[model samples]
Target: MSITSAINLFRQLTVDESQVAHQGQPHVVNETCLDLLLIEMVQVLRTSVAETSFAVPHGGLPPSDSLELPQSSESTTARSNEEQERATELLYYKVERVGFRIGQRLAERYAKDRPRFTDTLDIVKFICKDIWIKLFHKQVDNLKTNHRGVYILQDNKFRWLLRMSGSEGVAHATQQAAPYLWFPCGVIRGILANLGVDSTVSVKETNLPQCAFQIKINRAV
Candidate 1:
């Protein structure tokens, strides 16, 4: 289902603010969070279908002598690793772009009621507490900074990953979780960019139901 449709369904199920929130419970979807979820879901569906359609047919392997070599095993491994990293980074950028747009729109509306920030840290704090509470129904579990423009935001019970099962092993689980993570990573990047901070966002799944997002500021020279 599209995120907008899902959000409408959610709204239809709830009667009022009381239903949306209780004494101390997180909401299933907030304005931006549901939007991000929808974006991620669409991408996941697209990737799955595309991959299925493009599967390589079973065939004989290429002749060893015909294939080019990287000179040594270590060099081949390094080259392979570089390619993998490049692919990973490209994926993050795609996800981050979606989020950045969402953040831009959100920030315009958000600014209507908020005061100006004195520094970049203030904006990060807003994301950690206020913005996060709106999206997740609770503040981030922890926010740490290196005092050198890098920040780590940890969420112990990340809402989207809560229902994910780890029975399939970490690789499979991460595959399942990546789409959901991507949009949020984008959202954070977008928010920062909107706030005039150039930054990169990445996710690390330390364990099931536990995730950390690293936000690194990229200052202009």
Candidate 2:
């Protein structure tokens, strides 16, 4: 099966039946069907590091206005704002853990079909989608390339300005702020390493007033 199919199946089956979107008419696999979809998705990431093309950069991406953060002088005392921020971080961490879990399962499934990008980065996309939806309960629009060096995986439902520019300086930001959900590039690097890519990673943010960014991922020496 294609990686997209595998991911949809995993997400549909792994999630609670009630959580499944009844609006769409995708085939619903029985919960007892612990098939190889989960296995293939994980294995692709394990043995294919140097051969992947996503290791290089691609172009033609879109802007994610949600990625922008709030001003330093502003306030966020609302109970609901606090809650959404918490939910975003909680789900982000969950996705990171689940990606590793998925990768482990995939290594076994692909003991044979291990060739090129077809088996590696494609499955990572699937993993990203599954983890994203399973946690946030919404789809994140995937942006691969645009404006050169920027790609965005946006929260479909949570469309607020997702500014991660000044996350390090948010003195009031406990583990509860949106910046926790709006993770820095370093977090992505660590997540990628845990999945067995074996690469060094670095992150730098724009030092603008409130419009900061933890952009730039450099491979280490």
Candidate 3:
């Protein structure tokens, strides 16, 4: 969800001032903790970063040819490693921050309202509409899989992949001159956490066959 929406949800769920010191326990979670968490994020985001994680390294090194020239192959491999190490962090950060804020807001809402639901998948759909669809602007399909490691959203359609997954605090190799968007599985963790579901979502997809930069998600069984 957008930052504004998350903030609205959080504000709606806050406890009243009278409930602050009810009984022996604290009625509301401490603001200091939230401040600390935001501070940590600020520290991590102190510098500017690239817009996309799938960016390729400066090009001059052609595809490696082991048989043609051993010397060139070594340099190509070194360049590849360097590019991999140059993973873009901020693109993933934007995605994860969205998820984190959504989860926090949803959690706060649940705590405050004690809402009830009778419709099947109503709450789930609401979350998908507000949170998932808003950021990516793509249709999200619930996937069926062995062990169900993760919810598979087809990246082929919206063309955003590595942007969604924040691994090692970043999504690398997404902004490279790759053809399509690529999201890693790790990005969904915040959604599940905020949705009050279990953690451990996994994406086992490599690139798609025939299609460019396609990957799927599955839940860990």
Candidate 4:
């Protein structure tokens, strides 16, 4: 669906009398604002991890003025590699946590008026239609499942990645954009959790604006 169409739908959805009285009129946010916010959030988290990882001790001299013996190049490279991995892990945890909470609240609000879902597939369809439209302005392009608790949701034009590109080519851009997917993964997980489904959500993005989320439900014996 077009963004304008989605905004119109949102307007209709937000007209609950109680909500209006309690929260006032729902505010419309520019799509670009959310995009920019996500970009800036990732940057800030990365910067925070870098600063924390390399922070100097209060009583110790700065790197340039330190009198401590220098480590070998190999040791330095290994430490750098370790720090980079740690930073990436930390970034994913922080971003996903934020999205998870958002998804939980969104599911609670949107699913309240809907019929009770009958099965795991019913919940997945709800996500593909209602929740996806609410967040991405469109329904999922496709959904596939094996009847054994695994589902794959494909979006041909994922809104978040629509404007992302790099001069370094598609592969490079895809690599850089991978981190952003963590948030949506958390979002899907949160949605499922709130609906009483246990699952894990992962993403695969080999091309621009096209991505697939894999949901693996954990059914009890």
Best by lDDT: 4
Candidate 1 structure quality by residue, lDDT tens digits, 1-221: 54444434333321234444564553444455554556555576556434533342112344334566436888667855754565555555655565667766555545546788888889889888866776677999999999899999999988767777668797788676775687778778878888888998888555667899999999889
Candidate 4 lDDT, tens digit per residue, 1-221? 33233324333433344576689766556667667766776777778767876684222346632758777889877866766887788888877776676677678888898889899999999999988877777899999999999999999999889999999999899999988888789888888999999888888544798999999998788
In model 3, state the lDDT of residue 213: 17
Better of 1 and 3 by lDDT: 1
Count of residue pairs whose backbone atoms collide, per candidate: 4, 17, 23, 0
Q: In terms of TM-score, which candidate is strongest?
A: 4
TM-score of 4: 0.82
Candidate 4, after superposition: displacement of residue 209 in Å?
A: 1.3
Better of 2 and 3 by lDDT: 3
Better of 1 and 4 by TM-score: 4
Off by over 4 Å in 1: 1-45, 48-91
| Reference-based lDDT, each prediction | 0.68, 0.37, 0.40, 0.78
Q: How does each model score on TM-score?
A: 0.65, 0.29, 0.35, 0.82
RMSD of 1: 7.5
lDDT (Cα, 0-100) at 10 in candidate 1: 31
Please list the Cα RMSD from the true structure of every candidate, rounded to 1 decimal place.
7.5, 18.5, 12.5, 6.1
Segments in model 2 whose C-alpha atoms lie over 4 Å from true places: 1-124, 146-150, 159-176, 182-191, 198-217
Q: On a 0 to 100 scale, what is the lDDT of residue 166 in model 2?
A: 37
Instruction: Report the C-alpha lDDT of model 3 over 64-92, residue by residue, as the tens digit.
Output: 45236556667878866765455444434
